[model samples]
Target: MRTYLDYNATAPLRPEARAAMIAAMDVVGNPSSVHAEGRAALGIVQTARARVAAAVGCQEAEVVFTSGATEAAGVLDGFGDVQVAPTAHDALWAHHRRSEKGASIYAMGVANSETGILSDLPKRDEAGWHAPEGTADFLMLDVTQALGRIPFAFSWSGADLAVCSAHKLGGPKGVGALILRRGLDVEPLSLGGGQEMGRRSGTENVIGIAGFGAAVEAAMRDLAEGQWQRVEKLRNILETSLEARANKTIFVGKAESRLPNTSCFITAGWKGETQVMQMDLAGFAISAGSACSSGKVRESRVLRAMGFDASQAASAVRVSLGPETTEDEVLRFVQAWLGKEEKFRARSAA
Candidate 1:
């Protein structure tokens, strides 16, 4: 069987989550209505809200369900001066970049996507005249990649808004949540028949929501029980295996903490796309980086912003692990890489 290691993209639905979702699908009603059926659906939504809130260590009232993280980010970006990480999901960057004149906006550079260097958070003393203290009108964190698989304690980060996607943590797709600090003014993306406290309007996707909650709960349970350590070991195996193959190979984001399951690296003299295609043919599923912009020949903005030469940035590929990943699979991947590296070096020599 082919090993699956692209958890950063999306995870397979959990069995318990699947069953909960199936049960939820049977209850059909518009949550906006005051009738019995509607109230039942509303109950599911509230329960999910509490569960998700619990997962993220926030209040139930703070969780605003949305179509997904992209929309969630859009909702938060509507509020104030938007500052986005250069390596953040494109949705957040695009929204901030498109703001009108007089729009409070600033782009913070992160470590290169190809190099995996974490940028230091801006300091108060360094805020300069251009960006005064508390100048961040609204800070929306795209914690999609950092959640579930890593240690992320954002409660003290002072971020006004944050987005999390269910599918990223093995929950059902089509469901996500926006976590806002109490009393932030945000206009609803969908207004009319008010639902979700007038923030999101529509009949709640009960099944998806339930599944999302289950996934969050599962991830939290694993975190408490130390599953993260096991996963980290597997990831290290992959990292060491890759590093052993060639001297020119470079690992990205080595300076700062990163998700335990993710590894971004470049093979000397080999194009990322070529390696990706070859790996796919070898029955391995990896990424050239960011499912949001896979297959595009454009230079990675995250890499350029982090200061990598164009070629190094262009040749990076990311290998992310899932709960199901095995050491054997990682070994096989490294063996394949060694073969590919030899061929690539031979061709360059000619």
Candidate 2:
């Protein structure tokens, strides 16, 4: 049986989400139309907007639906003076670009992929341009990796804007949200007949939105029920096993507060792609660093930014779990991995 473990890339559709999408597919009406049919579509879109808004603990009006997190981050360009975590998804990379020279550049640092490291912003700013006691428009958090697994509130975090992907939390792929604090002007990325409150204009994907809503509902329920505890247990088991068998392996991004499902590490003398391929051949799927560049042959920038040497950076791999992962799977992977390591060592000696 094939084991799918690459959750950081994308999650499988939840059953509730699939059912919701299937049901919504039957409703044939353009949300923008003023007729009864159009009104029905509009109602569906509004209901989804409310559900998604509630999921993130924000007002429905604050949530602007987008094609995905990439587009969501793109919207942040309208707001000048952007600050992002160096560990943020590539979508937020544009924050590095500013119209004027010497603009504030803040690259928040995280501890690890799974265990998020909180930035020492106050410490990092001891010299000048301090974020006033509790004010400033200098932050836009990319919550794509932190959402669902962590209890993050945009309002509480002091972020002016936040981006989250639905699929990361078992939602549909084609839908995401760009949440901006009140009064922050975000110019539209796509223009046409005004939709998404004149922010994103296009034909609405009612079915995908419905599924996205259901998935968010499920994730929220899971979070409330302490379901992450189980995943954390599996994660620890994997880490312990790695420690027992690998001598030079080291975990990366050990954040003080991170998404519980993520764990990135590097093993000396072994390339990440080779390990990933071997894992896949053994019926387990894992990522060689970020899945965003899974096919590309390059060292992980995140590791290099953290000061790892080129070889260690090239050796990093990410083993992200999901809500569906089981303890048995972790045990099996550990056992299989230990056996592989012994064989490789013997071959090296010969």
Candidate 3:
């Protein structure tokens, strides 16, 4: 049987989410229409918005639905001075603009997607910008990878805006949200009917939003029940088992605050792409790094930013678990990796 373990890329769709989406398919009305059918669609959108707001610890009005995290970050496009964290995702990175004057807006990911390294939201003073009117000092945050995997609250995060994708939390892939603190405003990314309170315009994706809401509800329940703790234990087990046999392997962010389910490790001289292919052939799916790079496996920029040399950077493979992962799967992956390690060692010796 095939074992899928690439959660950092995208999670398997949750059954609750699937059912919600299927149910939403029957709601045949545009959210913007004023007719009864349209109003029904509008109600569905509002319900999903409230669910997302609940999960994010923000007000429903603060949440603006978007195509996904990439489009959610479009609010950043209207900003003038932007400073991106070194480890931020490419979407956030694309908005970076260096200015002679200090930056007023900063973009960052709450956690590093590739390495699972957690980053605390910087305070206003630390960011070198004062919160004018107690709002808009801090800019956007990418919560795509951290949303379901960690305890994060946009209401307390200090950032004025946060972007989250649905697929990261076992929802439909196309829908996501931008959480905007009240009283803060930005130019509309797409201007038309102003469906998302004049922030995002156009008809809503009812089915995807329904799925996202259902997935967020499930994720919140799992978090409250401490289900991720079990996944954390599995991650540790995989690391411990691998470390025992692969003495030369280096586990990234092992001693730091990271996502509990993620383990990024490097075995020098063995390219991550090769390991991923071999593991895939062995019925286990993993990733060389972020799945966002158009499937091109390259040296991890996050590793290089953290001062890893090119060799080690290029050799990192990430195994991210989920609530559904079991002990058997983790151990099986460890065994397969160990076998691969031995072959690499033998070849190097020969």
Candidate 4:
């Protein structure tokens, strides 16, 4: 009877990913070992690498596996002067360093997790878009939120480097990748046994990598089947139902291009955390904002960046859907939330 709607935080693990991980559990060899057993393990990692590369539209050699997107972002350190979008995820935003009027690297996310807003990358120019001459301008895109929910290709994304997480796309957690353009190099974050082509040196998470490959294949299949279009319809239905009943509600980023599964709405005088708790108790799982920022009583930076005042930013709740979400579940959630909104309105009027 419980409905799960917080997909932007983490997706339910795909069955293909689970099965692949279970199968990989039996493989007993270090990928760095030179023996037959080791070679077999190496083959698994290589195959997964190729699948991941194909999913992101990059060369296999360009992909370097990491613990997750946070570690992937660390690889970009010391690249150059760093500039970040205010709407970027905290992981990418934490790496920002002000540029001093010269060559600079831009780190921005393709999508905002809280508001589901999509950002257009800067156009390519002879001077590398926004940087000055005699400097190698680099663009780093955080594709963690955009990977499976929307169509993205690393080669066509106009990025010198891109990072994504496996768990965000139905793959196992703790496994992610950094995609670098061919012939571009970054200093190694970990130096050990010269693994990951010496870019990231450590024993690869063989089972997680296997699951990541299977999940990417399955996610692509779902995209090709137009499953997200159906999810978008469900999202619109949810929004319409809520808007019909609530008088003072605002849908964030309604006028912008967004991920089909995401809907972030705000109701004045009602805090997002309280609504999330009420929904959870009523058998629905939702979020006030990014899962990373959950439990913190701070306003959404993305909403504030979009010109929303403090109250609206703090009152926002995000309900993200998935292919498995049903129309009945969406309706039920709408009804439950509407009931709560009524009580809040009554108290405000009182």
Candidate 5:
């Protein structure tokens, strides 16, 4: 039987999300129209928007719906001087300005998608300078991986802006949002009939947005019930078992605060790509690094930024579990992986 453990890449859609989307499929009118059917469609959009706001801990008016996180990254495109964390995801890092000028905007992710390492969120100073002042120095959080897996509230994160994707939290893939601090204006990337409070312009994806709301609400419930803590225990068990068998394996961020379900480990001389293939053949799903880079065979930029050499970076693989993952499944994966490790060591000795 195949086991799926690549939640950092994308979560399996939650039943709540599925049901919401199916119900939204019948929304026939355009939300922008003034007709009765249009008002019903608008109601769905507004309800979903409110759900997203509650989950994010932000005012409902601050949430601007977008196609996905990649498009949401456009908030930085208009700025000529910006700094991005070395380990930031490509969506944000792609906007990095390398001209050696001082930055007025900084972009960083609260959690590393590959290693699952958690980072401190920005805090406002006494002068309220934490929020960007007229495109001046400020912080933007990429909350994609951290939103559902951990406890975070944009209302108090001290960040000027944040971006997240619905799929990362078991919602439909095509919808996402940009959380803008109240009273901070940003030029719209796509200009048309002023929707999303005139911050984003486009016909709403009714089905996807409904799914996103349902998923976020469900994720919030799981967090309140301590479901992630159980996942953490299983992850620790998996790591402990692997360490006993593969003495040379390096578990990244083992001592650091991290997402409960993620484990990134490096086995020198054993390519991560190869391990992923081997594990896939052994009936498990995992990843070498971020899922965004498809058909590319390069060392992980995230690890390299953290001072790992090319060899170590290329040798890393990530295993991320879901709330539904059972201890038995993780143990089975551990056995299959250790078997491959032994064979790889023997081949190197030979």
Candidate 6:
């Protein structure tokens, strides 16, 4: 049986989301229409907005649905200069780097997609002139990777704007949201018959929105039940098992607070891509850094920012678990990975 240890890339769709999407397929009116059918469609969107707001601990009016986190991050493009942590997701980092100098906006991720490192965002009062508490625009947090996996709230995140993808939290792909504090606004990226309260324009994705709502509800239930704690234990077991056999391996972010299901480790001599292929052939799914950068062969900028050399950064692989991941699956992956590591060691010695 193949074991899937790459949940960070994208989590499997939840049954609740699937069911919601299926039900939404039967709705036949555009949310913009004023007719009864249209009203029904609009109701679906509003309910989803409420659910998403509840999930992120924000007012429903503050949520603006978008195509995905990438498009959601575009809402920050109109801001003046933006400073970003190297650990941010590519979407946010790309826009941040393009902004003018003397950054007034601090944009970064709450949790790194590759290393799973959690960031301690500066408090509103402690942050300088452009603090979130002030009238000027301040922080933009990319909470895509942290949403369902950890507790988060737009009200308490000390960010003027926050972006996240539904797919990251067991909802359907191609749908996300941008959360803004009341009274703050962004220039619309899409211009159309005004939708998403004119913050994001275009027809609301009724089906996707419904699924997102269902997924958030389901994820919250899992969190409340403490299912992730079990996954965390399994993650520890995998790391401990591998560390006992591979003394030279370096575990990234091991000393820091990270997502419960993620582990990033490096073996200086072995390329991460090679290990990914080896693991795939061994009936396991893994990744060499962010899924967005998997096709490229380069060092991780996140690791480099943490002061690792190019070689060490290039040697990292990430294993992310999900609530469904089992101990047997993790143990099997450990054994297969150890066998491959042993072979690489032998070759290096020879």
**lDDT of all predictions:** 0.71, 0.73, 0.87, 0.87, 0.88, 0.85
Worst 10 residues of 4 by lDDT: 127-136
TM-score, cand. 6 vs. native: 0.95
Per-residue lDDT of 39-95 in model 5, one digit per residue for the tens?
A: 988998899989989988899988999988888989887665777877889999888
Query: How well does candidate 5 score on lDDT at residue 311?
Result: 92
Q: What lDDT tens digits, residue by residue, belong to model 1 across residues 1-350?
A: 56676677778887768987988889887677789998888888888888888877677888889878878877744544565666656767767543433345333322222333444554333332133223444455666665666555446545556788899888988889888778877778788777788888876788899888888888877777888778879878888776776778888775467667778886644777787788888888776743345446555566666677778777778887777777888888888877888888889889
RMSD of each: 3.2, 3.4, 2.7, 2.1, 2.6, 2.5
Model 2 earns a TM-score of 0.89
lDDT of 2 by residue, 103-211 (tens): 3433342223423344444332334334423323356556776676767676666555667788988989988888877776668878998888888888888888888
Question: How many times do residue backbones clash in model 3?
Answer: 0
Q: Provide TM-scores for the models.
A: 0.89, 0.89, 0.95, 0.96, 0.95, 0.95
- Candidate 4 on 26-97: residue-level lDDT in tens? 989999999988888888899999998988889999999998888999865766677777888888888777
- Report clashes for each candidate as comma-separated counts: 5, 13, 0, 0, 0, 0
Per-residue lDDT of candidate 3, residues 1-350 (tens digit): 89999999999999999999998899898988999999998888999999999998899999999999998887877776777888889888888775545335778888998999998666566535442223234667898998877888888776688999999989988899999999886788798887788998888899999999999999989998999999999999999999999999999999999998999999988999999999999999999963456688777878888899999998889999999999999999999989999999999999
Return the top candidate by lDDT. 5
Candidate 3, RMSD to the unseen true structure: 2.7
**Which residue pairs collide, candidate 1?**
115-252, 115-253, 116-252, 116-253, 117-253
Worst 10 residues of 6 by lDDT: 128-137
lDDT of 1: 0.71
Once fitted onto the true fold, the runs of candidate 4 whose alpha carbons sit more than 4 angstroms away are: 99-103, 131-136, 290-297
Model 6, range 1-350, lDDT digits (tens) per residue? 88888888889999999999999999999999999999999999999999989988899999999988899888767777766767788888887544444436778889998988898886555545343323233788888888877889888775788888899889999999999888975688788877888888889899999999999889888888988888889989999999999999999888899999999999996988888989999999999963455377577888888888888888899999998898999988998999999999999999
Off by over 4 Å in 6: 98-103, 126-137
